[model samples]
Target: MSTVPLIRGYEVVIGLETHAQLSTRSKIFSGASTQFGAEPNTQACPVDLALPGTLPVMNRGAVERAIRFGLAVGAKVAPQSIFARKNYFYPDLPKGYQISQYEIPVVQGGKVGFFVGDHRKTVNLTRAHLEEDAGKSLHEDYHGQTGIDLNRAGTPLLEIVSEPEMRSSAEAVEYAKALHALVVWLGICDGNMQEGSFRCDANVSVRRPGQPYGTRREIKNLNSFRFLQQAIDYEVQWQIEQIEDGLPIVQATVLFNPDTGETRSMRTKEDAHDYRYFPDPDLPPLVIDPAWVEQVKAAMPELPSTMAERFQQEDGLPAYDATMMTQSLAMARFYEAARDASGQPKLVANWLMGEVSRRLNTEGGSIEASPVAAGTLAALIGRIVDGTVSNNGARQVFDALWGGDTDVDAVIEAKGLKQMNDEGALAAIVDQVLAANAKSVDEYRAGKDKAFNALVGQVMKASKGKANPAQAGELLKKKLG
Candidate 1:
């Protein structure tokens, strides 16, 4: 029997802090454009630039979005939450202090469940709050001096904080991915890591069972899955080495170097007292009515977990296949189309997992941008099910269907690809194949198993693969014996 790996009584404790930029068209405090990839400072307005005599105004859409996310995660939405001031001195922070929810957050005390190693693990969420993001500081030699980009300033971000429930770097990474999927499905964040819409920071520490946790370190240079895994792995080992030596690990902020595949300490980690956090009088507290929370809850779409279960039980898809399809909202819709068109859920699962995904991944195309429409693909599958085309012939028909050359019926008729399931025609081809391969025929008569396959191949080739394989196999056996 295989055994699960252990860490010699040392458990890795992890927590994730994920920040996602909302998808609204305008910034949180001003009507300035929230569009990314614009010229530096072009998207800035008086509110975003922190000009004198400017006041902050909350965006209604941003609040409605936050409540939607809170309900999706089963979090408790506080009827009244206060926005506090977090003071800091960074060039990126034009306001010199960020408007954020500190003590009483908007949503609190929820749990997210995921499966790890044949069991279910629930990660406790401490709180999720809405906050305005700081502007980006660009350090480049374009004009031989550091520059600034206020385009991202004043953007609304949902900061999700989870309790220390993860036991490995892998589990922490999985939890991050789960959150990523939920937010994307909710249409709140775009989940574009390359463009910095979604960012993750992991807090890692080592602890003995029934003992207090060690001094934890935070890593921020990881954004993608591969880098997340590598950074956590490096940090855990580094913590272990520090404890093993006489040196105790210190609490601090750290940066990960993807090039070096290691994490280095940036500065001593600061406590809340270090920032001197106080309520910003300039901005009022956030208030949400209970009725508004109910409104947002009722508007949520079908989440992944619920949809996957329905697909497995109602649509008769395997658990693995259903999980894969529902992981992406777009892919799930495509699978439903295949099922709706053919009414053959099992057959649709096979084609989706095998051919459709293969072509999409090969061409760097998504299901939304596919040249083959879902309804058209469904029509092609129906032709295969009705014996209008053999398996090999189905590929050609699909190519034509997607290539703008012909529809399903046109491809079927143009290539003469209808299956010849008649016993009379199959028997004739089987007889001719056995007589031509007399050596293999004699070997099959003497109980040689491989010889049966050689004769079957010849029968298929003789009919140009339009022959029904099952009928041809039976007829070939009768003629050889």
Candidate 2:
């Protein structure tokens, strides 16, 4: 649970419904290709088009992916689940209805844990069901006419519904990001927001403290996390303004306009009865054996939560650092490779979280696309550990490495960035600094700590920023005594 932050004296409540496009190659019922960017109507087979004398056949890959997702979240995987036809009339839906799970979904009762800042929070899930997606109605490029693209029709989807537990927009974003990472790590979804492989719809409402739940409006089809946060913020403010002005908040489906940063009503929100859900006569009930679940569990990769715990116990990383290291499988692999190569877990963690992360963010790249390799970074960390270079010098070495230099030692020598470790040379420099700053030394003898720091800075300046700061302080203190 998260601490609910009040917005203008009202508590903002939010939940999310996410549709993850499964990674199966074929449609959920038909043999049509489920690939994106295909020519319109070219990939829709007779079954997808709802032609006479055609029957729907189930895709086993989609069901297996659903099972994998249920197991990953520690949800209950029902042995038997029924498919229902949700009656809805839309031009893009050739069948005039969607096949989905209603009463008995395949996955139920799970939780997703994430971090908002340094606090850990958990959001419980309501259900995750399998469904088929609708086709797209393209309104552009048809010269005042709409074109229907059936390539996405009948594609496999897992609609994960969450409880209304999020207290703020930041919590909602973190929860969505965690769910996205899990699906991609489980190999069930591609997790590409730009390609429409993953989408989110947020249900937002606001209520006074200790009052009943407020009327929620669904903000639909948020493809980016930035839009998700912005939409919720505007929606919350709008609802509060309406209540303050003696206007009732209406229950409707809304669209987020990124340009204006507001939400407009699309249609009145419908309940389950409005769709007239009933068991589908064409498809039989889905059955999953206990043995199948066991097999899938055995072949599954290590989960991110488990891996984070392992990093904490074995490598002595803090909880935040461990969580960051295991954000994605590629990132975890990168951290482990660097930690193992350098034999310095803490140092490696610091660099990855600080310098490496800053560089990656500035370049708008992912860990997988990092220009610096793990081995090269590990070697740079080794230089700092063995007293070969100071922290500032290491940054210069990293800059060279990122710019295409391969040899670490060569870069260090070329820039003259090596630390001044010679005992006699450093002692002589400290003595000279003491003589030059006699007034500062007298101030230090009078119990002024700032004067001591100034004297050390003068020593570093005399040695041209190559002296070990700790050693300089020690030599300065001894000479003054």
Candidate 3:
């Protein structure tokens, strides 16, 4: 049996609550535009402002997006779900109470699976509910008084709550990334954590191996995954130290300061009763029809898990490569296009994971934004397969392709990248290598493998890198015998 990872003799339990802002064009309860970066109060409708005579009308697009998320996660879309008013007062909230889902959320009970290192981990989701986002309080731009940006207010959000199943910060980040990818894959959200399109709150605690659960402190608004991991680790250590010194852990809502790498208590964590949730009178019960669910499902794209399985069974890729390829929808489509064009699955996986991913990361770009087209990459890989270019030659062609040159064969010719595969020419060079490196040949004949590799390198160097490395190695072995 596998053991849970312990930090300083304490098992860390982490639960994550992620908010994926729906990519609707309008607010959840009003006709105000939901576009970000708008001027404060410019986008706030009367309903968002909670004016005297305003009532919120539900956005069908927002509910459809929630249905999309639910179908993507295999969660049950409650045929009849009610919205409730969660009583709270803050500078950013125009209304004294916020409309949210309390007991009957729209999406209920799902599992998110992701790989942490080599181990596949899964976290159970408690519920995902539809709600309106609170406005942003801006303090930096104003001199003494804070300004409120109600543009984000009334924006649609699907608040996904997870069970306390993650044991380490790594698992939590992986789960967050998987869910982020899923939402982006489903086109429900943009998955931009930096822009606040998606955010996560981590509930963390530490306990000894068989003891009752420790008190959990909620870390609010971990906007980045890096911060999410750092905050949880720091909070776990602090809690363990407190317990070691015979001090009790207090439950509270905390904020992670990325600069200090520490968590500061914000307020005492509020329980359900503290919020005083009651069904909202302004909004009626959200009733989704079974046919609507089917329509959404029919339009849904294939999920990552299903695509990964197909990559494994049909393309003969390993689980790791399959998972990596399915990290995003665009990447999966790119890999499939290249693999089908080249008729090489493993080679396509290697190139994408190695050269393609490395180049994209170095430039801080995404696969969707890559300059090398799938068909172009396929052509380059095809050249390598047909012995038209060596592996090094393929890299040269790929570089040229990324730099805006499209014709693979033309680039190969201009760069003198075609491998020297002619039998007579390569055999003559192999003979020269064998004759010049008698000592190395003796070592290889006497069973040293490194000497054989050295001889192969010398032959390639002699041929000015035109000789195919594999062909040289085979010919060199034949000549030695």
Candidate 4:
């Protein structure tokens, strides 16, 4: 639980339902291809179209992915689960019903722990069940008519439901990001929001503190994190305004318009009974043997939390640094490679978090696409540690390295960025600086700390920015005494 701040004399409660498309080559119940960007209707087969005399068969890969997720989150993998038919009608749902889990879900009772700007928060998960996806409705190119694309029909999905634990939009975004990373890290989903591989629906409501929970409106299909935050913020304000104006908040399903940044009602909300869920006679009960679960546990990769703890104990990294390093598998591998090569954990962590991260964010690039390789970054850090370059000089070298330079030593030498390590030469430069800045030296002897910094700056300037600042400060202190 998080210590949520009150918004306008009311407490905002939020929960999220996320749909993650499983990374299977074929559909969940059919053999149709699941690749994206194909001719829309061409991918639909007889089973996907729900033609007469067709039956549904389970995809083993999809079940394995659900098991992997359950183990990762410490959730219970139910030995027996059943599927039900959720009755609904829409243009894209040719079957007039959806295959989903209602009573006994595949995964039950887990919690996702994440950080909201250094304050740790955990959101409890109610359930994560396997389901099939509905197709898309195309209206743009239909010339005032609507088109149905059944390509996405029968695609496997894991719908994860959370408790009403999140209290702020910022906290919700962090939780979403953490969930996205975990899915991608587990290789269960691609986690591509733009391609509709992952989507979120936020259930938002507001109430006076110490009162019963307010009626929640479900904001649907928020594909991006920015949109997720914006939709919740708008919805919370709208609910608060409605209550303050003496109007009751209606429970409904809403869609968020990204262009206008507002939510409009789609339909009145329906409870579980409205869907008329019942056991699907076509599909049998899904039963998992204990042996299969044990096999999966043996094959499971080290999870992020476990990896972060290992980084803290083995590499002597702080908890925050370790968590950041394990944000993705690629990032963790990069950090380890650089740390091992440089033999300096803290220095590598600082450079990665500060300079490397800034460059990646500016270019909208991932760690895998970074121009500087791990060995190259390690070489640069090595130079800084060996007194071959100052921190300022190292930045210059990094800039060149990022611009396609292959050799670190060559760049440092070619740009004359090496620090002045000659003891006699540095002593002479410090002596000249002390002689010139007589007033600053006198002020430093009289206990003015700023004066000492000014004198060090003068020495660095006299040495043409090649002086090691720490060494110059030591020499200045010795000469002044």
Candidate 1, residues 1-481, lDDT tens digits: the string is 3132336556788899999889999888889888889988898788876789998898888888889888888889989888887888888788888888889998897877665543556798999998988887776775876788878888999999999888887788778877887889899999989888898989999877668988999997467877888998899888887887869888999999999999999998888887888887777778899989888878889988789899999988877777667757888898898789888887887877788788887887767877777788788888777777778899888778767854788778888888897888788888788778989988888999999988888888999888987778788766655
Q: How accurate is candidate 3 locally (lDDT)?
A: 0.92
Evaluation by lDDT, superior candidate among 1 and 3: 3
True-structure RMSD for candidate 3: 1.8
Model 2 bad stretches (over 4 Å) = none
RMSD of each: 3.8, 1.5, 1.8, 1.5
Candidate 4 ranges with C-alpha deviation above 4 Å: none
Clashes of 4: 0
| Backbone clashes in model 2 | 0
Q: What TM value does model 4 have?
A: 0.97
TM-score, model 1 to reference:
0.84
Model 2 error, position 30 (Å):
1.8
Worst lDDT 10-window in candidate 2: 1-10
- Write candidate 4's Cα lDDT for 424-471 as tens digits: 999999989988999998999999999999999999999999999999
Q: Where is the poorest 10-residue window by lDDT in model 1? A: 1-10
lDDT (Cα atoms) of all candidates against the true structure: 0.83, 0.93, 0.92, 0.93
**After superposing candidate 3, which stretches have Cα over 4 Å from the reference?**
none
